[model samples]
Target: MTEACERPEATAGGAADPGDPAADRLEVRAAVFRGDDGDRLRVETLALAGPSHGEVRVRVRAAGVCGSDRHVLDGEWNVPLPAIMGHEAAGVVEAVGAGVRGLGIGDHVVIAWHQACQRCGECAGGKPWACTRARSNDSLLPDGTTRWRDAGGSEAFPYLAVGAMSEAIVVPEFAAIRIDPAVPFDVASLIGCSAGTGFGAVANNAEVIAGESAVVVGSGGVGLSIIAALRLAGATPIIAVDVSEARLDEARLAGATHALLGGPDLAERVAEITDGGADAAFEAIGRVQTMAQLPELIRPGGRAVFVGLPPEGQKVEIDGLLLAYEGKTIIGSNYGGLVPARDFPRIAAAYRAGMLPLDRLISARVRLDEVNEAFEAMRRGERTRSVIVFD
Candidate 1:
């Protein structure tokens, strides 16, 4: 954790201020970068706008480091840059904008990266993640703009429309999913993206059945989360494949009955474990080739899910002759098929019921100032989920 602020503790008394003036600022500091390849996020200060109509000002409590951020940094997911770069987060609603209903100041909430415009056709069609309005030239209203700025006059794009790397941020009311108060912000943070996507892949996408065999490749944060959800859902013979033994340990904790050392025969190992092929297979590393191989690991009529964010222009080739005869299906999972407002609370309730081990997946808790070290740990694959917590 960074030395600048104390670790956030659970409060019994009325929530008290931490006394850090930066905690309340339109002008603030954040890990930022410029250019489409928004890699190498640097610390900077900027003046950001506050909440406006149907928005809220959030004091970011904790934010999990997600692979999509890596994609943004690597320029694979071409996010507009000279921007703040975090999306998976949880926090308190410090201020609610005009017309915001059903939530109030001081509410604990998970910030959904997907900001759906309810009126948009995509949102009307049950695909909020595909909200075309999210990509509009003016995605942020003055209230939706970042809550930080530098001495120079320029705008900073927040990744997935809600960069939570900073001390505070301004987001849409729809982005703030009120969670069970019992859920810690750190655990709730993973619900924002990590748990949402991983678990959603199972519950919403694959709908894995009890006692079914499952495989999750590239067992990082998202992959491990899928494993956790499947375990809770009663999937058996769960196999986790990763190049790193340490992550494999994390996967075991998350609920993988078996961890296979990544190699040429990974698909074979999964097939062998399931006695033919897995009932379902998930690819989370976002490598086109790896994603393409997922179908081969599943049996005929089995389901294959891709959870990774592959780079632009990437393509994966497959053995069509075999797949055509197998009657296999390939599915692209977006945000784990999460319906934010509904799923966040359900996940939180599941956690409070002791049915979910969200804390086990958490590797570390650092203040916003330690954002750089968290990413470094991510680069080395040293952590399952490193959360950046605010005071």
Candidate 2:
């Protein structure tokens, strides 16, 4: 008898070698969204094609439910319909396609959601994070088609090109970076996005130096990671601001020198803490008010880094004269300005060495079916990170 969850049927025009793993279709349970209905996910069986040339297939071991994933569910982001939207994940390689080297089946790997095509001008200019093709909405393979289809044969797009909320996924070989087996799948999952983004923002974007003062607004997972990175960087008087007392407590555990509840006098409180103002301030809450208030948290000639992603069309206004006369700089960081291939390993090593507190960041471990509930918990601000651990 067949199992309760039957395998997905193969798509048309696919009669290849039966013995070749790359030619076969695998059926897996995935939390899928049919559209931007903002409803809970529908657990469905999806047919996933094997990796094509320059691609690798991974059996997802752990996937993170992040704020960005919630944004996609809330229709705050412009994503293709019928999308599988989790990006932060780590797993083991199950299959490898032609022309892919240095990775083989059974290799532990972390999925870097963004895969930069080095041929792009942005990539050549040393900004792979801005690679246009890598952020495509279609989630197309290198050959310009999707590897996923629903039970009805409708195409299923992978969000951010790495829909990791599934039992397995097929991604570009470059998107799957080999990781140490010593790093647990759950810990490695955070390093893929949250850890990398937060650490990169401090180390690369803000460039906060030792003895410098920094304030991180919003004490979510990314915010806590920013706090941890600030401490590692030896930034003095690291201040964390958040509305939730529980999150503020987490911030303190993550090495925040001072934690303050956000209110009307937040700016004044930060000023008093730093004896003037911060050398740099990071806005991890994606809100117009938070983004607008960042410039006021930093002193003259200081930098304000906006690490959160506000919805499109939402605008924030700052004093142009104050920005110009004070010589303050406001910049946006994508993926914490990280080069995943080079940075993921460093982050994993940091976790292994006990320098970065990966264990503290994980608030809950869940199953794939609890993903929607996990997102709700995130919306309620109850978890720093809720990881879906697959068996």
Best by lDDT: 2
Q: Candidate 1's error at 161, in angstroms?
A: 0.9
lDDT (tens digit, per residue) of candidate 2 on 233-328: 899899999988999999999999999988888889999999889999999889889999999999899999999889979999999999999999
**For model 1, what is the alpha-carbon lDDT of residue 79?**
56
Query: Which stretches of model 1 miss by more than 4 angstroms?
Result: 1-25, 35-38, 136-148
Query: Would you list the C-alpha lDDT of every candidate in the order shown?
Result: 0.79, 0.85
Candidate 2 Cα deviation (angstroms), residue 342: 0.5
Candidate 2, clashing residue pairs? none
Return the top candidate by TM-score.
2
**Residue 25 Cα positional deviation in candidate 1, in Å, after optimal superposition:** 6.3
Give candidate 2's total backbone clashes: 0
Off by over 4 Å in 2: 1-22, 135-137
Cα lDDT tens digits, model 1, 1-391, are 2321221233211212222223334666777867533356677886766565566778888888888787767667665657677888888887655555656777898988877677878888777877766642233533345444566776677776777787788777777888777899899999999888887899999999899999999888898889999998999999999889999999999899999987778877787889999999999888888888889889999999988878988888988888889999998898887888778888888889988788898999987677767878888989888888777
